[model samples]
Target: MPAGVTTEGCPDSIHQMEVERDDTHSLKRSMSTMQLTMIGVGGTVGTGIFFILSEAVPEAGPGVLVSFLIAAAVAGLTVLCYAELASTIPSSGSSYSYTYATMGELAAFAVGACLILEYGVSAAAVAVGWSEYLNLLLNNLFGIQFPDALSAAPDAGGIINLPAVILVVLCMLLLLRGASESARANAIMVFIKIGVLGVFAAIALTGFNADHFANFAPEGMHGISIAAGSLFFSFIGLDAVATTGDEVKDPKKTIPRALILALGIVTLVYVVVAFAALGAQSAEDFEGQKASLATIVQGVVGSTWPGTLLAVGAVISIFSVTLICMYGQTRILYSMGRDGLVPPVFAKVSPKRSIPLVNTFIVSGAVAILAGLLPLGILADLTSIGTLSAFALVSIGVMVLRRTAPDMHRGFRVPGYPVTPILSVAACIYVISGLHALTLQAFVGWISVALVFYFLWSRKHSELARLQAQAENLTGDQV
Candidate 1:
């Protein structure tokens, strides 16, 4: 038949099965570009911008401005590259699906593994950050601490992370009720987060002290690059907008435009917020003031309630982020499982909930433990590395698909074509180059785990193989 059209029941047939497999349970192609833009805006704009400012600024001084610009530039190239691939592929599972259609089931599985880590760690990291702000809101509003033993991660001197666990469970419920909620809720939260940051901006700019910028780049360009590595995590959710291909109308025009719109909006917000925060407080103060956005706000507004309101806004924004990231992680894994990369159960969406229930629970269990155990800096590094790598792959996939399936219907094309994808890869590597050696080791560890899964189970048992074999045998027999 036509390309991307699968002939049923063939081993080694992933190339043929792409369109066929998604025929069932795939979402309706009904999302407007605006809706899709909001989805990306929703996922990418929260936790990192809200909570990461304090964590990142201290490393780069006011030179954190350069760091934000660097991260945004890298993400923009990836978004252009992603825009093309998502339209060509036009399906879910984000990078995992893109890799599958362009590469092979094996490459797809490894990408799936990486995406799982990216989305999963992202969800947990956001959750942990959410918890910090939640605790902050509680402490300021009611003088209640939720018992530090329960609020903190167990290893962090808490018995149970009730807030984190409760939030995960809460997000699970929301996701089960509606996948679309992830996007819509995310849009509203993005505005709130932007608004709060705006208030910070209005005040901080008025009192803007050029003195705080005197030591800009104090840690040197190396420090600013390291800060870029950290800030890159904030850009993670920008691609979630591309995942709406199955539901997006006129994806070629819609996807690319939306990608640009969402990226531009998110970058502007992030950069301005970082600048305002740097002006309001020194970068060195960020690490010590992790959950202190409200504290910084109070410095600007000169009112306890403004800080309280900001904390509440952060809590709301973070909760929504945790929910959306958790949902995205489970769905990516479910897509891989359906292709036979992991256990078939991962592909089995709950008849009751319509979610990939087994995958959700499994991912939830893993991330919960991570949230309860890992330090914030370590988790942020791991997430940034995974996302950068995935973005690079999607960028490269555009070139691969262009050469391999030259006539493929493309709804969107990267403007500069070949050169853009190449530069996208180069830029991702540049930011990744700035990552710490230890973080690189952790990323290597994660990749090794994914490859082990690929060789052990995914390669031979893959659904793609079965379909491919069947197709080849039929073609030979007919001849």
Candidate 2:
């Protein structure tokens, strides 16, 4: 046996070699910095800015602006850690792959579970939000809208959310086509969404009222913190850039550049849109406002045309969000499947398309079911908790890799080193702490289920374990 192969499970020389081999042979490196950045921005901006204000504004009142900054701060810190790790140890699994290389297989599986929850549930949540705007757009243009039974989830007093399910299925088809195709589609949507938001800000500022600022912090700092937790769902796209590590061209340089660029674009758009929306309407009025941005615009201009335009933009932009979210989820599962942490079917790529066909289908089906049955609020909260946990792990992984493999070549180093990662971890924890007790409880239960699966199945079937056993047998035969 080669000295690089070892029974010890830490990612040593052999593991790095295997990862490189997989990168070279498995996924195509077709994504450029611009394509990847659009993926990040597309995955992020629509979900929160389009409809999340309805949920977040109620929690923080006029102070939801602070909530946006709070979430952005945490996301900023975590993306730095992601940039460093992605350049240092590129993988399709994102944080889960980072944890495996630095921490070991079991810990990696836990992070994988968190990521599954984050991307999968967030995809469904975004689709549900998409359905709202789709309904509004239809009503505006054609004077027709789906009945509540077809447009809403069961929890929202409907039989099933048909539009949401249809959206997920459409994204699945895009993903099945190929990565580059999806990125191209995403880029077009990103540009349209940005233009729409710019229009919204312009129109909304016309009605800017000073009184909205009168009770800015009505719910205080605690409320701001809670809203930040919910708003963190908006930032999941920043890390979605890292999940394309294996599929991005020159990932070492491309991933970090994309992460920073996407972060800047997303944060700027979010703050501008939130400020404009708040200025146009009182914080109290934001609550329960479906298709909130469009409604705000209509009120400002006293014309349905402006609102209809915004609704058109929301419908198109939110589709890109759902597409990228599902893309990220499938890539993560592909990595896990390759490592024997999940079923092998997830690892299977199409010979012609070079994409995970079965995996995309499975993810789409599951997300479709979730989007059809559950309310958006529940899906968003669950996604936030899961995403925060994964972000925390990535920050910790940076520190662990520094200590364990100090000599590893890093394409980009975090500027502040230990302080940066520590702060990232702290920020994630603080936001997570502000989540509702029910959310925390649900996350705990999810983790428990993951651990049980890890023990009974993943640990035994782990690719690392199989390799270790083979190495030991070879050594014994040599002896």
Q: Rate the local accuracy (lDDT) of all candidates.
A: 0.74, 0.86
- Model 1, range 185-242, lDDT digits (tens) per residue? 6667767777877887887787677788888888899888888877877887877766
Give the number of colliding residue pairs in candidate 1.
Answer: 18
**Candidate 2 residue-wise lDDT, 393-413, digit = tens:** 899999998887777677899
As a TM-score, model 2 comes out at 0.91
Question: What TM-scores do the predictions have?
Answer: 0.88, 0.91
Clashes (backbone N, CA, C under 3 Å), per candidate, total 18, 0
Candidate 2 clash figure, as a count: 0
Error of 2 at 122 (Å): 1.9
Q: What is the C-alpha RMSD of each candidate to the true structure, in Å?
A: 3.5, 3.4
